[model samples]
Target: MKELTPVTIRPPFARYAHGVEIPAHWRIVQTSGQLGIRADDSIPEDAYAQAVICFEALSEILKSAGMTANDVAHISAYVTARDHMAGYMRARDTFMAHATRVPSSTLLIVSGFTRPEFKVEVEVLAAAP
Candidate 1:
């Protein structure tokens, strides 16, 4: 006799996790939407800088869960400016340089975010071994 149970990833998702979980013994990390704001409360104001900052914050969250970018299984990115697409891509590639695996990703251009001053936001999902 087996019963089904759900897992609780977390709130304000620090990666990209849903509240529900499945029956499995796997480690997961969910991060909240990350913006380009620096530790000092200064935003990059540019796509490239924003992208880098967002990914760096994601990395930090992953690390807290004993994981790395390699463990990432999916990523969702939002850019405020389409003109900065190339710059954002460059920054993303550079940041994931050491990623264990390149996970599936989606990039979207949006009119704006909660913070009008932000240029980019990123959310990631990681499954650990």
Candidate 2:
């Protein structure tokens, strides 16, 4: 994979690339948006905690496909409000800490989720050869 940061454009606002180029013949996997809910039917009130759960769930999904964060091509994350941005970013950074390459990322502030207690939701697109 190649990070596509053109000289003419401004650098990414965070620890991610403006774009990524996946090689031909690589297999791609996309995940549905994961909420912060746990299997035990527990949900955290904090955005960071919720985001962490979402990432962990995503990791499991990746593993099932024989891939990892290193193979991720893009990330799409959503939060309920503006205040959750910091927590979401922190969780996202920690999740990608071991990634071999930076991937494209998008963060959006939405009105809300299915459950009012839900503070964060995340999904990813990954590619592997």
**Which candidate leads in lDDT?**
2
Q: Candidate 1 lDDT, tens digit per residue, 68-97?
A: 877776778888777877777787777677
Cα RMSD (Å) between model 2 and the true structure?
Answer: 0.7
Question: What is the alpha-carbon lDDT for the whole of candidate 2?
Answer: 0.95
For each candidate, what TM-score against the reference? Answer: 0.77, 0.98
- CA lDDT for candidate 1: 0.73
lDDT of each: 0.73, 0.95
Model 1 scores worst on lDDT over the 10 consecutive residues at 13-22
Question: How many residue-pair clashes does candidate 1 contain?
Answer: 11
Q: Tell me the lDDT of model 1 at 119.
A: 80
- Show where candidate 1 strays beyond 4 Å: 1-24
